[model samples]
Target: MALTVELDIRNPSGLHARPAAVFVKAAAGFGSDIRVANLSTESPEVTAKSIIAVLGLGVQRGHRIRLRAEGADEADAMAALEGLVAAGLEEPLDEAPPAAPVA
Candidate 1:
């Protein structure tokens, strides 16, 4: 069976380098055949596990994309991806250094 879901791109930088990499990594963790299509741009659906293909979709902030997964783990894959998207693809920020040892 196939599971489909529509997700909004809320990442500030869109699906660029890091976010795309993260997305591809997440998609790869599942046994499902995952695909994503840019609804706003009407782009063709591409394998979600490919960073190049995901980047080729040209997805931008506020754009909606359709995620389709087919396999035994389709439901779990969809759920995980949906949560990731809802979280805005946030990565850990760089830590600040000590302020000159508070001299």
Candidate 2:
């Protein structure tokens, strides 16, 4: 079963390195064939599990991204990815933000 989802990237910087990495990581978590496409003129197809592929597509803020997954876990994969994109892919960086000095 293959599922498709479309979402707008609302992040100011668009899907940059950090969010792209998070998106890729989330996509890779499922045992499914995941792919993403840029809804631009080229409509380029990219591997969802590759940050480079996502970046290479030149996806920017307001661009629509389509995700397709085929496998047993396709539904779950779609849901997870949909949530991420809908939430602006605003995941916290793996490294914690710099701590402030105590008063």
Best by lDDT: 1
**lDDT of candidate 2 over 1-103, digit per residue (tens):** 6888887777666788988988999998999999999885367678899988988877777778888999999999999999888776775423333458999
Q: For model 1, which pairs clash?
A: none
Question: Model 2: how far is 59 from its true place, Å?
Answer: 1.0
User: Each prediction's TM-score against the native?
Assistant: 0.85, 0.82
If candidate 2 were superposed on the true structure by all CA atoms, what would the RMSD be? 7.3
